[model samples]
Target: MNVAWYIWLWSDGSALQLQQPIVSTTRCDRPIEAVTAVTGGFEVRAFLFQSDQDNCGGGGVVPISYVAGVRDGWPVRVRPTYGPLATCDPQSLIVPLRPGGVVQLRVDTDDRAPIVEPAQKYDSLLVSELAVSPYLPEEQRGDWVLARAARGKELICGYVRMDQIL
Candidate 1:
């Protein structure tokens, strides 16, 4: 619930216009980069660089998008969701990712370490500390991973954590 409320009613009905800040962007320069060699229908969540300080013309920002809810609610009739992934709550603005989809990523261990910020929440961040495992193993554990992307609107980037897909 970072702030994604689109409940309006103020034209002569009183008050109900939320924060009004919905941003699900894609400019490129960092975060969202996973390409272990995926290309059978599309599965490359983010990569764009016109100059990573000076890299120049190197692009790729695929199937990765974020936002949680928007199908037909008001905000003028918002509609941007393809569904393959797109979690909710951290504000809302999801779309894209429907090329060969498979997404289920959310891990929150204990003790500490689990704060990844790329677009305020997470588009990619697993750190790989041995595949992660430490949610209060004895009392002080840690691990973290949670970008956005539910399914059909595709927003969250790279994240596996379903016991690492078994």
Candidate 2:
């Protein structure tokens, strides 16, 4: 199945939307330079996925929330919105990391209240990636170090994968 995902970034009360067109049948891994250019001091990556469930139908946009933070260091305290029809649990947005240091992130849909499943043929699932990242400094660019910095700064470097069921 073909999936289309839109990646956006929000920081310091500002939002930077990406301009890259992404499509994936299985998975996608790419840099979100579009947003980093404006943020100018962080790194973020987003990954979106399509569920294997069957489609229901009643189509409507849902709100998906993305949060990131140190695993055991602190609680995830970031909320980004994705989709108008997506719904995920609050715990899914937690970022998990090792005691020493690591960046972990979680994405989920925020279906404010609970309601019976829609009669639509489309299935509700989670589609997400790392999030958005702030632009990184030249000296801070490296292998694992870059990833660490991006995570530590709470940068957004993730993407979300959305599938349209016909």
The candidate maximizing TM-score is 1
Q: Candidate 1 on 84-116: residue-level lDDT in tens?
A: 232332322222222233334422222221222
Go through the candidates in order and give each one's C-alpha lDDT. 0.31, 0.27
Candidate 2 global lDDT: 0.27
Backbone collision count in every prediction? 20, 51
Off by over 4 Å in 1: 1-12, 24-166
Error of 1 at 12 (Å): 9.6
**What is the Å distance of residue 60 in model 1 from its true position?**
16
Model 2 ranges with Cα > 4 A deviation: 1-45, 53-67, 71-77, 81-166
TM-score of 1: 0.22
Q: lDDT by residue for model 2 over 75-112, one digit each (tens)? A: 22233522112223322333332223222222222122
- Candidate 2 deviates by what RMSD? 18.1
